[model samples]
Target: MKNFKSEIENPIISKDILDLENKIALYYEGKIDEARFRSLRLARGIYGQRQFGVQMIRIKLPYGKVSSEQLHRIAEVSDTYSRGRLHITTRQDIQIHHVSLEKTPELWAELEQDEITLREACGNTVRNVTASETAGIDIKEPFDVSPYAQAVFEFFLRNPICQEMGRKFKISFSGTDEDTALSFINDLGFIAKLNKGEKGFKILIGGGLGSQPRPANVMCEFISVDKIIPLIEAVLRVFDRYGERTKRSRARLKFLVQQIGLVAFVKLVKEEHKALSNQTYKIDTAKFDKEIILPEIKIPSVKIKNMETYNLWKETNVIPQKQQGLFAIGIKIHLGNFYTDKARLLAHLIKKYAANELRLSLRQNILIRHVKEELLPFFYVELKKLGFAETGYNSLVDITACPGTDTCNLGIASSTGITKELEKVLTNEYPHYKNNKDITIKISGCMNACGQHAMAHIGFQGMAIKSGNLVAPALQVLLGGGIIGNGKGRFSDKVIKIPSKRGPEALRYLLNDFETKKEDKETFLKYYDRKQEHYFYKLLKPLADTSNLQQKDFMDWGSNEQYINTVGIGECAGVVIDLVATLLFESEEKIEQAKASLQLNQFSDSAYYAYTSMVNTAKALLLTKEEKTNTQAIIITEFEKLFSDKIKLETPFSEFVYQIKKNKPSKEFTTKYVQDAAFFYKKVTTYRTKTRSNGNNQQA
Candidate 1:
């Protein structure tokens, strides 16, 4: 025992964090709306929303591993600095709602003290890095991904070039193909892989979920962690320079990945990787003994022969542990919620008894790893006392839902309330489903799809209705959704809408239908797929169509708000281009203009000039510099430029300047272009900014 030993320590937040916070606070409060405020807000994790009076703040949690102390701090921050609640986003990041414009700087400083940050969490930058919690510990895992995830997080924490990219970039790492880390659906994903004796990762780039969803592309076969930064830098730089700068919506890396094949994209990334600094993957594992060790556990003695209850838990609740004889137990939390006191207690209990090792699952649940099998029964009793002893993990009652109407401003319906009721109804009646396999029932409060209801087995979406005097909210039924293998899955389709009060009944009908319609142990999804949606909806006749309101899909018909006649006395007296007659009437003027531009040449169609002019006018009015534009909409501009001379019956519009690539002399243009111009023209002009300027007037 010569003195050849080592020591370990936890890293603290950088001192510059405080100084940076001060500078940001001065800028935000003083209305110093210069380059500095813009720069810092991107760094401080502040995101401006389209809603009139609110903002969303994203908090970065490295490796999906968070401290109980940090959780409590966040809870406090929500109660004091925000809307008294914290939102767990799909990206494994926490979002704070309705934060006052002034308190942000203080909030960032507090997070800095806890070694957490908002820097580059949002705003066209490298978002929070995600990794599998079982990175090194799960035997199913090929290798530990924590080091690689940590490396990427630190490498791009504030890298200047990659800081403000085309849009936010999401990076994820998975140790196994089981892929709880959602590597397949990220902007950059690395699923662990090995060949021969060399251990490495499978790289994917460009996946995202929004209005436009696309899966990522695999760039590397198996690149060592040593080149992770350079590889990422190369990919992002290509996205920055070549991505569509004109359109905000289509500017995601996926669009570029589509335009340039994955092979070409990886080639560019490999090129950029050569220019960046070469970093080492060599870490001294001995340096972080505390970080690597499991949380301390309070070993209790429950010496009994029958371990049936414990066995059930081991079968359902526990996940495989990479270390022999150790397992990770999943403590299912309904709707990813725990009160302040409950959270605080769990933190201490975990640190003292569960080896200080806790991880959150994608299903909005918690997991405690490395608990000894013999001490498990005693641990189960403790967990029981904490009111968390529900041994059924991934059972019916273990449903996940977004906060919905309880908190979110964008919520269309009540998710937490519905999830709670749905969970109770299923657990009370559908106990047979656990053996059937893990059925995920997710609920989204609104069309924004926060719950990712798109990926659940039986998804419920919240929607509102305008009935005779009152407008009530209700849940819409979406069946047949879940993970097939890895992250490749399809979204559930909305078969019908059910009133909130009748949700339990509707769900029961679905479960009952599953039993009767299924053939010899066929899974629920298979039956639903074969039976088809109409057959299923036919079962619940009126319940399926709860509103019974003639649903013509607002987009297909038209905006109800546009029907309001405000062109006469509105504050902003812009023309309301609603009816087809309005467009057809414009033909009279365009024909007259066409007579002048044609120079004695008789035009075949007079309505063509009129239609083109109307569309160009509408396009000009809709497109403006005060707002951001997407490249997908550039065709409208191109149309305007192509029909300029023919569209001489136009008022001076600034939007026409950039539209249409070249105003060449031509005569072979068809009326289809004119019709397209008119079709898109009406949709663009009818759009209105429904907002209130006074911040205090808005409600969540």
Candidate 2:
């Protein structure tokens, strides 16, 4: 493969691409451990798909903003390196699957030319920073959150504090109290606010969705915008130090905050304040507040063949921007899957007639902003040709679904197949509900909730049900979950489990009941809450009966073969390995990174890198004794217990490690911390060598 390292303009990004190339070579040559390589690749946005060899590349777009040129670049890269398909994720990322792992470096280089990145899009690092797709143009917003979201994305892209954490961290920004960005379900969520003429944010912390969904607790009702980034840095530092590690199921920031009560978590976060690089980082919104330049094109006259259909589309798919005389056109992408051929055409259309930009919505749709009202018909005509003019934008027919069994390794059933069936049912049987934005439907292939099923008005989680000796794919129906605005949200309760093939019928029953019994202005969630879980369970109980199962029930949706309940090891967060050599090797890498950051005069980053190095070295040694090295806190304490006598330090081991939070990350302190880390690493390495020399070591 040709190396594109020299073509990358940013030296840091160039080094990143070169490092990936080197790592790939090392992995192929069996120099790096498989688990270690998996972690490395995943952090770079190279994910292993359900298909064995090909990888999925997640392109991280901050706040979902994409320029026409960037879109063209992405489409070109897709055509060149992938199968010419793009899948927009719920986190506002673009994913291209069936890519060769070896070609990823080059593909990433191509993307970098357009100022797009794949860094930290996955793995045990900060994922994509998402926000409201209508951020800059929301009428109800106190201010646009695009600049804040972009600032956060830039600050943490390759920051040492969050890299190699126990699990992935997620952050989001909402432009208004409407909470369209779903702030209640992220690690750190910010809602734009204005208090007494000062710009601020309402903060939510430690929210997540999986088998067990937890709503975020209010960290504060309001905090100045300048303090938000610092607060988030402190939170990440706390999570990295104290969050669970060994058990993948309980490694999220939510689990950490839940384990130690929210009060204690907040205290720990406050303790990290001094260690942060900036006490107050102000986000500049001047660039984002600039006047949007719309294309100056003569309005094309297009006669509407179906005036009623165009009107329905206008009602459902068009959003009036806060800016006068301009609009935002919503394209309801089916299953979030669109091809590069159409992508190119859309790119051209937006560049020629619109604002040369679009936002990939959180619900896996496209929002073309800054369109003139006169251009609506032209957009409709163009989008319809590409099958992007589906009605029900953010409505009942606009279903949110994960890639499920199609490409995801963790998927237990076909979420897309069932989504298609339900859409058919909704469009054909209940067309009146097309514009019903009150109800939300989401599907996840498994309990991991990548589809965010737990937070939907109507949710389905894929599972397996047994009938005698045979197993069939099933959907666990959940109800009564939705955003309640202003950082408050609800989680759905599992009502019943039905065969996967009957998913459409399950939707039909729920929607029918909701349609008939709901009060005049009652939302789906309100109706669900009134009816309650038991009532829905009773209503859908007939589909749960397995005694009268047909052969088709044995098969999963969109599959010809009978269901076998096959599930591979999930890399939603990369696998955690305890290989001692790999750990030591990683420790050395961290030390090198610390030194590099120190040279660059990044004091806090250097200190954190050194801290990670020390912890990693201690964990490596502790693993030799077969000790439980779960969290960094545990690693620190256990190291003192087991190796305090063996390797004497100037101060107690805990005190030495705990200096990170005790003092500010000054240049002098960072230099000393790096030295201390190096000394500790040397002592541990010498101790291990002596133990091995005397034949006292149990393992290498």
Candidate 3:
């Protein structure tokens, strides 16, 4: 009911926010369908929470690099529109929850004041492009991958082909062979490399984690940096044309790679060369190559009250930067959460003492960059005052957990509650393992693996144990999973299922066993491999007894009420497309977008918009006859088979549509293609109208 003025310098972003406001109004007025509205809002990063009426807003932060001003702005917006809490995600994005849908536009507008965005942060588009938090300062990196990651993020933010895909796509860049960004579990993962003294990346394709986890195939041992963008574009084109649409589960790129061999997928990508916007889109790393700016003020003298604690913190949380006399400090945020009161202080501290930049890590922690060596004590003191100077950042004690039953729609059990309980267990009981980086502990509320539970050394997935019509909260303990660097990793194996309350004891059993039997200098994975999954299952099997469950066993952590698994509709997944009028309307909108792109002389973008328009129109016509239209390539082939003989056309429908793949996206070709698409839409609509006039008769 309230109107907010947008001060965003980018007119496109301003229009997007206003459009969201208009759409929200239309949906409330019963003009827009709920499904259509859901898709629109998701693209803008406004997601439906497990609790009805309140929405979750995911702020898109490319590679998790946030400026101090951006951090301040996010804190302000969170305090104003929603709760003061900020939740950092494993994807290297920040999410704020409990915001009103009607007020999202104003909230987004406020964030735009500091050059932040919400576009493509959710939905089936290119989600946040994550990278190693230690990208620029990592001593082992060949070159900084931040610039390349940022380039890809900007190139595909509003790309038409990915705007409405069958499923969400994820990409990541690991700065070095350590693979700290966890490249093995992304749709497209890039590992920074030096090939013959040239900037390049080791490319991995089609890897993903969900209900089914798949390892990415090695697409290339080395691809030049300049050509990576074009390669990604080509892969996206192939996916848009051939990826599954009808089945949500089988629609990810990983499933496509599984259905068709990686070799075939590579061949399809190569076939899209003619349609690609650029053969080599060179990135200007000069912009990202700037030196860290430090304040000229003198470092104030600070006294440490406890030398032992400070030493422990230094050994665990502090990291030496590649740059001389500089350090990077890791802030272990409990469950990746912090309030606005502390956020503002952090923003001020970094702006004045550090490099004016902070990177949110893939493990749901914050890494403060470019702090002078002498400022460690001062930074530590200041951070401790904010309740953020916790030791064991990114260690075994630094547990990663997703907002499961707390806010996520697909949460089956409680992740955050278990995470808190486990943290307490580690702190009070196993303090000696504070610096144990060999073991990773991750938890997810569901099998979707948002917490990256499947990739941890010790993983827990929320489940329910049944005993004759009664269900109790439970956890599936997993073992022997971790990143092995250089594009190699292992997905954890499910070891045993136990009651939720016994999770702490299960962890204690595993640790005690490892402590006693692990060989000297052997990692957790090696020790676990020696013992095997069955060994751990047998060890923890005693805790899996459900027949003797008590009343407290049915209660999940951090809740007073009894546990009940109520999973809502997940927005992270793809949406189903079925409405005919919506399809036709989208086609018209695509045509208009094509015209706008053409006017701007962006021939390649315009051509893709036109191609989508033609495909959408075909889908609309096919829906009228109740024919199957799943993928764009299929629609093109089926349209020719079903309508080339029935409708009079100057050229065959296949030839007309497939021209996109046969010709370069030059101005002349783009213009002709757009005109042809408009003509095809007109003819299809005319036939549909005539058929509808004849008592809704079905015609091919």
lDDT of 2 by residue, 61-164 (tens): 99899998999999999999988999999999999999999899999999999999989998999999999999989888888889999999999999988888
Instruction: List model 3 lDDT by residue over 451-491, tens digit each.
Output: 98998899999998886677888899988888988888899
- Every model's TM-score: 0.69, 0.98, 0.98
lDDT of 3 at 49: 92
Model 2 clash pairs are none
Q: Top model by lDDT, which number?
A: 2
Misplaced by over 4 Å in model 2 are: 696-700
Candidate 3 Cα misplacement greater than 4 A, ranges = 1-6, 696-700
Q: How close is candidate 3 to the true structure, as a TM-score?
A: 0.98
Write the number of the candidate with greater TM-score, choosing between 1 and 3: 3
Q: Is candidate 1 or candidate 3 better by lDDT?
A: 3
